[model samples]
Target chain A: MVTEKIIKVHAPATVANMVCGFDILGFAVKEPYDEMWIRLTEQPGITIINKDDYQLPAEPEKNVAGAALLAMLEELTQPVGFELTIRKHIKPGSGVGSSAASSAGAVVAANTLLNGVFSKEDLVRFAMNGEKLASGVKHADNIAPCIYGGVTLIRSIHPLDIVALTAPPLFVTIVHPQIEVRTADARSILKKQVYLKDAIKQWGNIAGLVSGLLQSDYALIGRSLEDVLIEPVRSILIPGFNTVKQKSREAGALGGGISGSGPSIFMLSKDEATAIAVEKVMQDEYQQLGLDHHTYVTTIHSSGVEIIKA
Target chain B: MVTEKIIKVHAPATVANMVCGFDILGFAVKEPYDEMWIRLTEQPGITIINKDDYQLPAEPEKNVAGAALLAMLEELTQPVGFELTIRKHIKPGSGVGSSAASSAGAVVAANTLLNGVFSKEDLVRFAMNGEKLASGVKHADNIAPCIYGGVTLIRSIHPLDIVALTAPPLFVTIVHPQIEVRTADARSILKKQVYLKDAIKQWGNIAGLVSGLLQSDYALIGRSLEDVLIEPVRSILIPGFNTVKQKSREAGALGGGISGSGPSIFMLSKDEATAIAVEKVMQDEYQQLGLDHHTYVTTIHSSGVEIIKA
Candidate 1:
């Protein structure tokens, strides 16, 4: 017998950094999410009906949502069929945790349809597996924040220890200049070995960011939220990235950097005015470049992944 | 005519790592410091005056304080003869910012007696020069904290930018296992290049420490306070280093590592009882090692340097 159930989920866009945190930290946003609709079918196969028709993968093993739902089912004792319809709102390869949103939303929808068999943590693990299948690396710094919400720090990758940091009352402004830069190409250009001095400088910034966050010393946070090591190397791949960052800082941003493996830039501010100011600067820069872009001014999210409407 | 004036000053002990802040960030201990005294002479020549005859450099040019003071005098129009008498309390190379104490104290004393020509910042700069003379490198992670009083993060060494971190209420337990490890030898033994994987792990820990300190997440702080890259190479120089760390952890330390370039190990705890517990464990381990050792159980010093009654 086919158990027909419709479940809807929203996965927020995320700024992968608040300055010093590169691949190891991120926070979720309030709008511009990837919504997914999931239902269980009697047919023992996986199929993705790409409602947005964004040339998304339909194969269960290949698609992010499909891969995650299949991974979750693989852990189940009984075989099941799933129909996942992904509505891609967060742009693909925009450095906005796109794959994370799809994976998170799918697993959440699938698990919800199955009467919530797997725990939230189990969902994160399962989503990570799907992420690995999609991105070829199992990094959860971005995914955890998208799924769990709040400012998240990934202490380790092998053991996958994720901690939700105490969220400061803040806003995040993100700009995705519609320039395409493949993640694979972006990863290839970075030098394998860095100077010891650069490494130490990066550590200092990390330390400053941590202390700033804890003390709510916004100025220190702004001062410390600099990426001397990774951003310099990675920003070269994104057009007008340096300008955006400079302009954003001028616009009264605490600080911002290339979001995730960019083509997108993110700005973090203490208030809505600063966030809006950052957004305007980024938008103005993008308009001058004649590149279409998307922007978000968000607060620090304290919640991760949850059922939206079922 | 000779003017004999007494000055009393205190420099705080500092924690090098706020969990993941190893080697890159440190803050001052507010109290329990090493004290020194300086006296001017009209004998028309520099004189040697070591109170305890602790085998430090007796020649004005060779002494750390003397070297720094001489350097400062060289920048001035007037060159004066003086005798430095140090009533040493903070043990040298104990990783409680000892060299920092001497370097900073010397400049403070010299600057004070020189009619207050140099500012506190100028003193810090001069002391760092002394540090460079001693360690063959000019990094102010330790010296700035000792001089400035609170938590200080050395962001850049070349264009030296020091950011003062607002540290929360914290307790510290420092144990100096009497085995002497020369800073020169400790530095010499470190390998030039570490594995990329290990470097990545180290960065994650740094990020964690920064976040842990910022949010005051004690558990996160403890978990992030690890050094897989530099510590392993440096720890080989100190006997029973690993044992003390493991035992201290078991005894409830939030976590700690080698104090500066050590024979000293420092741990942070949330409370006095926990710090005491960790200190006892460290002391017991040193006793078991059959080594004559000393341990200081104290708290995080919010103040850096102070002038006390002579």
Candidate 2:
């Protein structure tokens, strides 16, 4: 039997810590994905073939994609060697789950090459090892959505339960400003103890947001997008975050807030025209601050990692 | 136009603090309702009539139903008088939103008699004044569900927003072990500061529960009903709580925990047969403890505070 030489996969970027659901909910976006190519090797060690504009580590163990593939390799009964090549388009530290894309993509490509031995949930579990390497905390918020696509709820981390929720065809506007905000720093700013009252409100909004997505209620989704806890503290780290959010709402975004931990802001709209309008408002706010930013107008990507070439 | 002399309404009992939702979520049950009769009077002050089995206050201002009526009356432009008669079936301190039935029923009945003057939101706002009289703390968990029916989420207290979620036909098994567990006392036992990790899990469960209800996913609803925070503390107050819950689940209940701030334990099941089976387990547990208990097999009430006779 002849073994397949090469397999390539694409994993879309995900929005983590969606509005009211900090570390609990996430969903995938259409654009800004990372592509990975894996080739079977004779040597019994992993190697990174290319390094892009982002300063990804050349060492396989240190690299995000390499770390994920290494974790997945541990479970295989037979030893396998692969050289992984990653073309990273999703910017690192942009709060759009850049590392997750690489990690999920690599594992997916490798799993396909190895005759698909793992389930999607198993892939997510394996990919989380790399996520832990990238972001210290072994949370599945980004990886779950990046692997499953659509809106996902991380019900319990200890039990590792993830639920894929039904959602409408909603347009997304994301603006990633050219500024670095470390996830650790963004996390450090949050209070360890939140007011119980605030927690109640946050949970209520989370329930509402889930309902809004399932029901395709644009107004309810907008109303439930108010985050009283995490965003208030982290929004200060991003330049002109408030202005962009306000202008996005003014320009007809259903709702929006800081995407993930920092510099990137995202909004959801009901229509393509509103999404385009929301993008202009975000661009205008960032442009006024004389900041270079990349904005993408896209829709919710319901499917996560996919094989592009084999 | 000749105004009707009497308006009577039935307010169904509600289960508040639904598992992981703490102070924000609630849903109504079909049985154990309170009936309120309101008659127009010549005098411009409130009066209470026909309080049975419960030592309700005669003083209109201090009475739960009367207080809610007074709050609603204040919004009336013209001076009007109402004499209220309460037929209370839901017992006080049952942890089944008994007081909320009275308050919500009164406002709903009076609002109907006054020619639909107040909106449902306004009715809830006024009913909360009465809830404060009953529980000392003004919370809308019970009142919102009792007023709006189905499963309701109290998204914001400041803005007083309530979202009614669509739910499938779900049967509920409730066992009230006749013991006094004051709402205030139940609340006092809880730790003021919960671990942030636990709060995150609770909120995630809240989102999942809402999604489960909307999607009518019975297994998901059962899975999401595990409360790691409030129930652990409050369950201690109820005798045979743990055994009842364990037995209920053993008997094929979807899931269950302490209902509200218990002496009452409730379980949700997909079918009436399972609900009935769950009730037997609950009864057997409390019966073995030689405690007086009342058990009901009911379904989710989709409408709340309806006029039985006008």
Which candidate leads the pack in TM-score? 2
Per-model TM-score, in order, reads: 0.86, 0.96
Name the runs in model 2 displaced over 4 angstroms.
Answer: A1-5, A42-45, B1-5
Poorest 10 consecutive residues of model 1 chain B by lDDT?
B14-23
**Interface C-alpha RMSD per candidate, 1 decimal:** 2.4, 1.1
RMSD (Å) of each candidate, 1 decimal: 3.9, 2.0
Angstrom error of the Cα, residue A65, model 1: value is 1.6
- Compared with the true structure, what per-residue lDDT tens digits does model 2 show for residues A155-262? 888888899998989999999999999988888888888777788889989988998899888888999999988888999999998888888888999888888887
| Residue pair clashes in candidate 2 | none
| Fnat of each candidate | 0.59, 0.81
Error of 2 at A87 (Å): 0.7
